[model samples]
Target: MAGVLHRAALRTSRLLQCSKRPSRYHNGSLFFSTSSRRPLMALTGFTETQLTVRDAVSQVCSQFPNTYWQEHDENERDPTDFHATLAKDGWLGIALPEALGGSGLGISEATMMMQAIAESGAGMAGAQSIHANVYATQPLAKFGTAEQLESTIPNIISGRCRVCFGVTEPNSGLDTLRLATAASKQPDGSYRVTGQKIWITCAQVAAKMILLARTTPLEDVEKPSEGLSLFCIDLDRSKHSGLDMRRIKKMGGRAVDANEVFFDNYAIPADSLIGEEGQGFKIILHGMNAERCLLAGEALGLGYAALARATQYAQERTVFQRPIGMNQGIAHPLAEAYMRLEAAKLATYHAARLYDDGSVPAADVGVACNSAKYLAAEAAFAACERAVLTHGGMGYAVEYDVERYFRESLVPRIAPISREMILNYISEKVLGLPRSY
Candidate 1:
């Protein structure tokens, strides 16, 4: 894994150099492949395997189209059939290793699957439904003990279990170091945790929780980031004592329930700790880039979906004895939206490839992933907005589904990390600017 990361950095550096300097055509011909010129495929340069994964996921998604997702969104219900269908088809473990009964692919493949899901018109609701299942297991895969891995990972891959990521707090927000969540060590080697978590996706339905809590008092630690630990706890949400989970209804992505959770005195066994004590922050950082990559891909898919819908409507809807698409007023915005989405899509996939390369430095991965996330979110939102405008009043109507797309597009701009934070990251980490926050 370390080698993979290192290689990723060198590969990225080389790509940058080539992009900056003129390419020397050592080959006799200067002609590039048609795939390079293609709009969507050019973004990712997906391998044959990845393309196959895309097609397969698309086929599965086609079963439950916009109509299916619209119903789920309107009812504010979980896309149980969509979620189960993907899990049943074994698409849930696209990121897990084959040894653990997974396909053993990388983040690129995972993003492809996720993007296809979103592009199927499932939108954020579709992507969020299975997002944690595909992602949150990595910390365990990379850092957990033998007994822990043997017991937990298989069930996750097989879709017998669902785990909710418990990290963000109501008050702490992005400043994780100051979170008040605490887990005191018990005489029996277990830990008693008490904390509040907000925006915990799928908490209402999750059977397990990958939790992070302060193991040692922050004042006692050398750094604020120290003294924290990660744990995987059995979270059967039947309103048990010391465990309280409540659903928080929101405007969009209603298919997946985001919740507020309170752990009054949750007891977790000693073996549930994912990695070494006081090192949870470092371990958790390992999967952050992957998370960003997946989110970026999802956003890209949504943008493209919106663009497709808008262009299709413009071509079909006739006004003044000609298709709306024939007019520059409608055609130009759709064209611009297409360009923006394609650019963002390229960045998103490029970051995914770099993440999968396993050779990039952590700092480098952070820059790429954050940039991709920011670009994809902005682009997707723009596309959705334009789609709504192109449809005019019909876009605002639920019958057309563009309004839903427009509403759900707001998710990527705010979640995982905010656009302002991404800008701050690039400025401080990449450009060597003084920390703004």
Candidate 2:
């Protein structure tokens, strides 16, 4: 697998080689066939398989243009049609194990697929509509019993059901090891859960939730990470009397709903537990690195999308008898943003490749993933801000679309993990400094 990926990377680099000729055409045509007119496949060392995934995902995304995303954002409606289209195309299974009806692709391809979705103008909202399925189930897929895999993975891949991740809480925030949600064991061996989870995306529509809760009180455990358990619980409110979710109106990514979830005596069968009890922290760590890699790719795509729009506007929008792109002030920042995004893209893809290779050390993978996510988020934010500035008055208008990109850029910066936390990690782990947090 590494040999094939290495060959494909070299092939992609050759394809991306820019000739010294004045004409934009390389040999005979543009580097990337996608409408975005950017060599995204080449930017991050795409394998042949990855290139195919990128193009196919980009084609799916092309059907849903900026106008489609604009209407969804304005109405704060779910992009179910877009999500359904991707599922129909079998993209939901891009990173799943083939034994369980998935495409069996690695995180590298998944990152490319997500980047294509965002670059095609779906932004974070479009990519996020189907993001959880790709990463949240990693624990279950690896450690789940045959019964769980046979029943659950197929439905998710085939779009018969949707799942949401429920790890964050209203009071705990980033202190995941200190989660307050509790799932007490009942006499019948079932579990009765009661707790609140905040900022849960897609709770309004998800049929299931991958939840983390304390099976034993913190005081009873030797360590804070102990006694925590993970469960795949039924989130269908109609079937469960105590399960409820209230939508939170957010600043961006309005197409998907974020909610505060309440579980009052929610009953889950004994079979719902994933992996061994008290090992939830260790199991979920696998998915967290995957999340960082995918999120970084999503951020890079959004940045490239904004930069593409700004570059086009600069070239076409005339001011004072000449295109604004003629001025160094306008062109230089866009150029810089492009360079920053490209650098982040490399980091993002490197982290993803490291994740898929599996030969790298776990500590190294964690550092790469967190650093890529942090850099990509910051770079994407700058690109969006510059895009808005390039459009001047029209940037704020929904029709222009940069404002939406700018709003959605904040998601990667804050979700899954924060920039500050990533820094603290690098400091203590890499620099061998004392723990700050």
Candidate 3:
């Protein structure tokens, strides 16, 4: 198995020809090395760092093929081997700070890495296995104290501590500011949290959770966004009393577990809080945009993968002694899907670039990220649908793998944020229209 993985990794990595240029950091900014020849980069305009990340991540993902993901998805098991392989290769720390045992690369490189992973036939399930690690810790990395950075960041990057993001709740839905989860301060400066968090991914295996709860009561605070606090707290049910998790049987991406976590007066140390008190809504917003960008990349990759499969099938599957691809009716939709995927790819990468630049305005970043996510998810769904239609009967069969892709495509469309919400945001924020919802 090890030898197979090594050879496959090498074969996949050889597909991309990168320049010998290196990416370096100077004064907390990443500068990618440029090449004059620009091999395979004229179309995408990917820098050395981005291309290198894509190549390396594709190599890692190639080891776990479509069948590997299918089996895990069927059995409802986490792809820990795939996760550990990327972690061992230092891919998990692509967007983290260098001083904290990471490569200190920007979101552009991280987005490329995720796209490569999904494009390598792992689909959304594979991309989601380590998704939180890339974005959930952004707030901690930026606002954490010296002690928090020194102890927590290194351990997470090293894969010693796997963490899950806990923000969504059954009652709150998308109204995050109205979350009822409370973290009351105690005499010893510890917090006793009590509430329920639903749809938390990888909670079954994660050792820590980035939890957002109300530190000050809603009535006591002037703004709904205020009174909220974020915490990087222990999630061990065995170690901590009054904490319970019930695994949720989801529609797709079953490889990673989603749970409804219950915290009934679960006590956490005071040091677990991230950033300042009553500032969690602001801090988590940083991660929310990053998550949207990453999800967009994942959606783009899934679309591309599905399109590749459909195109290959169309060319090989013959009907009436001619390839199905020869028919304009069959060919045109695949071409359209390809175009959609390509367009979404551009939007996704553009959002990542805007996010990493740091000089761009927050409203601009929000627009780009939300638009990218909405476009990518819609495109991916269309591509997957077309791929399944192109396959006809085989599309419904799990053996063909398009069925799985089709099911998993819904993830990007409905998760982190919905298409309707994206439209609302663009309407209110971009058009300066009155609030609709």
State the local distance difference test value for candidate 3.
Answer: 0.83
Candidate 3 weakest ten by summed lDDT: 24-33
TM-scores for all candidates?
Answer: 0.90, 0.92, 0.91
Which residue segments of model 2 deviate by more than 4 Å? 1-44
lDDT winner, 2 or 3? 2
Write down the lDDT of every candidate, Cα atoms only.
0.80, 0.84, 0.83
Off by over 4 Å in 3: 1-13, 16-43
Model 1 residue runs over 4 Å out of place are 1-44, 238-240
Model 2's alpha-carbon lDDT is 0.84
- Report how far off residue 125 is in candidate 2 (Å): 0.4
Write down the worst ten-residue block by lDDT for model 2.
25-34
Candidate 3: tens digits of C-alpha lDDT, residues 1-437:
23223443565456543334442211100111131223211245777557656666765676886789889999999998888988887777888887777888888888887877777778888888889988999999998888988988878877777889999999999999999999999999999999999999999989889999999999999999999999999875875598999999987888999999999999899999999999999999999999999999898888877877777677779999999989999899988887887787788889999999999999999999999999999999998999899999999998778888899999999999889999999999999999998
C-alpha displacement of 377 in model 1, angstroms? 0.4
lDDT of 2 by residue, 342-397 (tens): 88988998999999888999999999999999999999999999999999999999
Clashes of each: 10, 0, 0
lDDT of 2 at 62: 64
Candidate 1 lDDT, tens digit per residue, 1-437?
A: 23222333454455445545443321101112222323332434667566667656765776785778888898888887778777776777778766677667888889988887888788889999889888888888889887887888778766788878899998999998888899999999999989899999988878888888999998999999999998889984455658898899798999889999998888788988988988988888877778899999898888877777776677779988998989998989888887887788778888888888888887888888999999999999998999999999899888777788889899999988899999998999878999988
Better of 1 and 2 by lDDT: 2
